[model samples]
Target: MNLVIVGLGAIGGSFAMRLMKQGYDRIVGVDIDEETLQLALDKGYIHEGTTSPEHVIAEADIVLLTLYPGQIASFIDENKDHFKQGAVITDVTGVKTSLIRDVERLLPDHVDFIFAHPMRGSEKKGIAGAEESKFKEANALITPVSSNKEENIKKVEQLYKDAGFKTITRVMPEQHDEQIAYVSQLMHALSVSVVNSTQASPDTLLFAGNSFKELTRIADINEELWAELFSMNKDALLDSITCFEEQLDVFKNALVNTNEEELKDFLKKARLQRKKWY
Candidate 1:
């Protein structure tokens, strides 16, 4: 199979490495940065690397787009004609509603574009940080539009499974966005807010614990990429924040009233709810 991975950043490079390890040859890496392409090539994550997709896209059987959501539409708009006939295109984008709708509308009928989100990543960025282990035991969400062919959707699902994902499930784009708003985006916002709430000092490090370090780990983030993601899913994220604020207010009121019963009940319920995940 001839596979092309666009962007060649952390997630993209990791995907190339895992797929290559699974015995799929002809893996190609594409990126705007020549240095990133060179790093991917040198690391042996891909068999070939290029700074231009136009030259190699015609022969690609599958293309994994790891670009930011905004860039995906523009890239597809410009290179739709270059895609090989019957190629299956997938993505690792975080938020999906607008991107999936726009790409579905613009793509040629000859090819299939199945939207997917591999629910795994690291705090690090770039090809140098790529690791195949990121996908182990992670859930991959396949969000397919009505226009997608069932066979093509299955192919995309199998692709992730072959890359060592533990589970694959399907969801509509709207639900995917809503769930991600709470689970992913809201957590990032909370992490950033927590980290920024206090000025850093030697005293701060001296007093830090595992909870503090774990909570703020994601706060050391790629600002530009996260800003784009937060903006693209603004409405859903705002709804999530409002929900969180309501719960926080309840806790604040309980503390102000010194209601031990309310506080205990809240903590107990939270503990019980969290236990369900295990």
Candidate 2:
């Protein structure tokens, strides 16, 4: 398969690398950054690298976009005419609902845009930060509409599996966004908030426990990208934030009243939910 991966940052570079390791050889990496393209080439992540995708995209059987959530639709719209007929285009962006809604109509009638999220990545950026191990055993979610071709959907699933994802779950776009708001985006929001909340000396962390470090590890975020992401899914994220606030208030009330039973109840509820995942 001639797979053209656009925006060769960490996710795209890692996708190219891992898929190549799996023996998919006709892989091309595209990025506006000359340095990133060179890095991917030097690392052998992609068989070919380019600064412009106009020609490669036209020839591709599959295109994997790892651009920011906001840039995705615009990129597709600008390049839709170049897409090969029946080509399968998928993405690794976290948000889905609006993207699918926007691009599905703009895509060539013969082409398919299969929306997906890889469920994990590093806070680090660039081709240099790409690592195949990041996708190991990670959950990959495919948000395919009923109109999507069964063949294209399967191809997207196999692509994620080949890249080292252990599980593939199909979800509707709306449902996917809601769940992501709670699990992925909400966690990032909490981490960023916690890290920014600190008014203490920087060395305070030196005296802190592992849990604090672990909890806030994701706070070193890509601000522009995440701001676009949060804005794209504003309603769902706002709902998630409100729910979190309600729960936080429960903890605060328990502490203020010194109500041991209520505190135990809060812990018990959380434990039960955590146990469900385990």
Residue 214, candidate 2: C-alpha displacement in angstroms: 0.8
Instruction: TM-score for candidate 2, please give it.
Output: 0.96
lDDT of each: 0.90, 0.89
Please list all clashing residue pairs in model 1, or write none if there are none: none
Tens digits of per-residue lDDT for model 2, 130-192:
887779999999998878999999999999999999999998889989988998899999998
Candidate 1 yields a Cα-based lDDT of 0.90
The residue ranges of model 2 lying beyond 4 angstroms of the native Cα positions read none
- Give the C-alpha miss distance for residue 136 in model 2, angstroms: 1.4
Indicate the TM-score of model 1. 0.97
For candidate 2, the 10 contiguous residues with the lowest summed lDDT are 196-205
Candidate number achieving the greatest TM-score relative to the actual structure: 1
